[model samples]
Target: MTTCGDGRLTCDEETIDTIRERVLSDVSARAPFDAVTGNEDRVSDGAVSGDARATKTDREVAVSVTSLSKRFGDGADAVTAVDDVSFDAETGSIVGLLGPNGAGKTTLIKSVLGMVLPDEGTVEIRGIDVYDRPREAYTHVDAMLEGARNDYWRLTVRENLRYFATISGVDPDSVRDRHDRLLAQLGLAEKADVPVRDLSRGMKQKVSLASVLAGGATVVFLDEPTLGLDIESSRTLQRELRRLVEEEDLTVILSSHDMDVVETVCDRVLIMSAGKIIADDTVDSLLRETGLHCVQITSTDLDAQIVSTLRGQFDTFSANAREAGYQIEVTTDSDGLYALLALLRTSDVTLGRVRTVEPDLEDVFVDLTAGDRTPGER
Candidate 1:
């Protein structure tokens, strides 16, 4: 037993596991909802089973939120956190949620998870209303929040997996094979018996993720899943997540500040600002729709006069001194590009190299929310 920071006596891991088993058993006896089983069949020999695989052509809605609104405080002091937000996450896909600080992303996520009671709106999981049928609706759901600390420190990696599965109303034994697969995929197999506290921060993050999927949750929420990981470890987790989504019909709602991860992994992105979703579309579509293009030009003949002339003509023009030449970047459309080239020709500027700058998700995010000053829930 250990005394927690709050001065509460906490039972040992064995004792806690026992209590969890009893609670699950009692809940099963009451039959509020059928326990999930046969998850081992979802994967076989390190591959997704044919019967469990989901494709984009036949995807189903995994999560649906409509007109969700939440406000804090009351009267004059009241602040609306989520304002009539609505979206759907499809099965076998990763949806990225993004927002600047105080943009209501956190409030929207909490409301959907039933962690916060919204003043209005509806949340549904797997076609079941979350507020009206939470027990049934949550059977297909799991979440890993706060990154590495989401798992038990005292429990071993495998123990954490089994514990989460058991508490989620699944028989741990029934999914032992699936747990083994998760361990291997996440590179935790060798440390299966090591306590989570004994592992590195990145490894602990992986354990938290494995625990989320241990119970065969079809819809999962991951926040900064690669928070403490190195480049290779982050890539490994990203590949595993995509594989799970494509192979096992998993639906993921991923929230992260890493725009590269969001662009590479998520099939679609929802950007929130001022307590509402301001943008909803695929990364490619969003980029194209921004209607902005950047071009970089390197020239040896770009003197102060030429630079000032270009800057005066193009508001987005920026120039940097380089050993070989002056490198300048300017935002322009096709017509503007032609005009820029013609201006450089008239100035007799000798160009060294020119290339197009690709705009990423972060660029689009900033462009959209650049003018937003409305404060909202963080």
Candidate 2:
């Protein structure tokens, strides 16, 4: 295996070959693409022609985990990485898995993907038990871990896609149209024939994503998918993921430290802490339930005395000097907002501008995981 600069590991060519041989041996009797393309009556602009997106009622449970747990070492040195966690991901939706460092996010994901066996509980992919029927469970699943590491640097962009497709029990010729469409949708058509080693870091990341989808897998796991992308490239990739989920009925389990991306793209988020899920809800619901509000007040009258007074009263008080005046921000509840306003009025502080700051996913995450020491992982 090779390690990327970001400290994530990717499979080497020898490891890739081993995995391919194992998959081929296990799924030798699997049917071809024709047998999988049952939805031949629908069409979408970015998806294969005649492949309609599945409706909510028609969507099946793509992944399920029940009471999963994993631990490392023995006796007094035992460390639990995943603690009886359970969740289900439906087809045509993206579920975000988030946590701070050493929060068991990696171990939980590895257990779900069958890379590491859990000490307890079970995992099912497409209703097939992963441990009981590894071949069948993995047939509809694919993963792109550690950003751009999933692609072969020595191979051309198109060749990498075809190679992955072949390993997934697919015929490259059969998915030729799909590959073309993927390349076009990801802005990689121009680089299709170019070697991956010759592309920019961001382009290589996109190639990794395209190769993962080339196999036409129904369920995919992505780790830091937009690591090297610029703002525009990140937005483009987000749009493509939404399109794939809506048009091709793909299921995605996305794990990333970029809270902005998760907030924008995920249907639901699962937050882990200390080997346990601390929060699970839609982004909007989590924001609403936080009951935290931030207010920013700009005033030339915000002298050092007033700023110091406000800091003493509010735990989340912060002040920055602006061109025209001093801007002060305070995070409080609804009741505290009234108290703050009353204090300002009594201090004879004339506010030039008052704005309510919207709380985002990052704020919520930090609030939830505060005071937790970094632990776990053997």
Candidate 1 clashes between residue pairs 3 or more apart in a chain or in different chains: none
Evaluated at residue 97, the lDDT of candidate 2 is 93
RMSD of 2: 6.5
Per-residue accuracy of model 1 over 252-274 as CA lDDT, tens digit each: 99999999999999999999988
TM-scores for candidates 1 onward, in order: 0.80, 0.80
Candidate 2: list runs displaced more than 4 Å: 1-55, 301-319, 335-350, 373-378
Error of 2 at 355 (Å): 1.0
* Total clashing pairs in model 1: 0
lDDT of model number 1: 0.83
Candidate 2 local lDDT, residue 335: 88
TM-score of 2: 0.80
